[model samples]
Target: MLKRLVSAWVWISTGLIALIWLPWMGLVWLFTARDPGRYSVGRWFRLAAVTVTRLNPFWKFRTTGVQIHDPRRPYVAVANHESLADIFLLSHLPWEMKWMSKDTIFRIPVMGWMMRMAGDVMVIRGDAGSRMRALEEARDRLRKRVSVMIMPEGTRSGGGELLKFHDGAFRLAIETGSPVLPIALAGTRHAIAKGSWLVGRARAIARVLPPVETAGMTLDDVPALREKVRTMIAEARTVLQRELAAAGA
Candidate 1:
């Protein structure tokens, strides 16, 4: 209980600080950022999130195979959603990717405003018009060579297992002719469980698998593409668990 309190305090304090800093940074980004579509100002918030995770005595975050340095080659990055901590853990990767977050997240005060300034896509679940607009925005981002990150599961699993993926991400990849980058997240479920505020100590791993190209693929291929990427991430998650265990051993 004490540990959870400490972790929770760290997160809350960090969030409060972000509420102050993010908006200032957003203002600066307007003057300095080159492309509105590829604006990376929100990365400041993501970096702050990384710092919060690092300051928490209960969590260790790491990433692998994420050396996508080419600015010209944008991808449709998809990952399994295990816990809310997955967002911060994935941000540790070197490259930048626009997140396709739920519209509700975009309603949060400073954080939401930062997301808007960063050109992240937002979708309202069960709202077809919002979904279509989000898709169109994602496609436009890809065209501008900005990679987009999507959690295909639509929600956190709160467990290590992969949930059934939605078709929107895969369909977006097909429509944009972008490569699908499969990312596997392991151990986040132990860090912060869904529907709970308690935080726990854990080592989280994010593995970036090889990209699956959708150059010649069509809408008819979305289901197969989604399943294939889902399987790859699941297998990679299993491998990551073994690696984490061995490291601890």
Candidate 2:
């Protein structure tokens, strides 16, 4: 219970800090960089998130296999959704990507404003028009050398199992000719369980697998591509869980 309280306090304090920090950074980026959509600004926000996660006493986050150095090679990065903590953990990766988040998240006060300023894409669930626009926006970003990250599961899984993958991300990859980067996350569900507010002590692992090229691929290949990435992540997730268990032992 005390750990949970500490976690809650960390979130509240960091959120309040973000309310002040985001706008100031925005102003600085506007004057100096003149690129509001630049990935560097997004890196600043991600650093703040990593700091918040580090400050929390109940969690230890680690990442591996991230080869995001090449800015010229933008990808359609897909990952499994385990918990809300996955966001902070994944942000630890060295490179920045435009996140495809649900529209409701964009309604939050400071965080949402930061996301918009960072040029993250938003989608309305079950809205066909919104989905199309989001995909179009994602393609545009990829064309401009900005990688886009999506959770193909669409929502967090309660059982920590790989949920059935969605076709939207795969379709986007095929349409844009961007390589599909498969990312696997483990132990986040143990850190902050689905449908629960309480936090627990856990180590989270995020692994970035090799990019699956979509070159010469067409829409008809979306189903196979989706399944292939999904299987890769599932296998990686299992390995990560084993490593985490051994580390704890």
Candidate 3:
């Protein structure tokens, strides 16, 4: 009960901060429209996330297994999705990357506007043509030197374990001839589990594995690469869950 109470207060306080900062963020974006790279809106996002996680002190993060990069090549980062906190955590990735998210989220007032100004791609999931359009948009973004990130699971899993993988992310990487960067995010499930409003102070680990080369790979490679990523994430999830369970508070 006390944990839940503290979590509620934290969420409320964060919401209040967003109410204030989001508008100012929008204004900043407008003034710097031509200089998106000059000012990183991601800094503001990371600050907010770090503040919330640090508020409880117990909430911590650990990352590992990130592959060496060329820094010149564009990649489609594919990962398993498990919670809303995934967004903030993923933003903490080393590179300054853009996201591909649902179209509906881009409709939110200041938040959505900021995302648009940041060169993020919004996709309508159901409409056939919309998916293709989203891919094209992502390719264009990559051509402009932006790495595109997508959650291949599409939606959060019921538990810490991964769900089915969607071929879309893989297909996008293949179509664009960009590398497929596979990441396994553990600990987020315990921090803020799926289908729940409650939050916890558990330390989360986001492990970035090696990137799979997609260049010169045909459509036939998608299925095998997808399975490899899925297995990697599943193993990471199991290891994380066991560690967390053993360290009972």
Better by TM-score, candidate 3 or 1: 1
Indicate whether candidate 2 or candidate 3 has the larger lDDT: 2
| lDDT tens digits, residue span 21-66, model 1 | 7767767687657766544565565676777777788889999975
Name the TM-score of candidate 3: 0.83
Off by over 4 Å in 3: 27-39, 56-58, 67-72, 243-249
lDDT of 2 by residue, 53-150 (tens): 87788889989986777965789999999998898899999888899999998998888888887778999999999999999989888877888999
Each prediction's Cα lDDT score? 0.84, 0.86, 0.73
**lDDT score of residue 130 within candidate 3:** 85
Best candidate (score: TM-score): 2
Q: Give the distance in Å from residue 31's predicted Cα in candidate 1 to where it truly belongs.
A: 2.1
Query: Model 2 — TM-score against the truth?
Result: 0.94
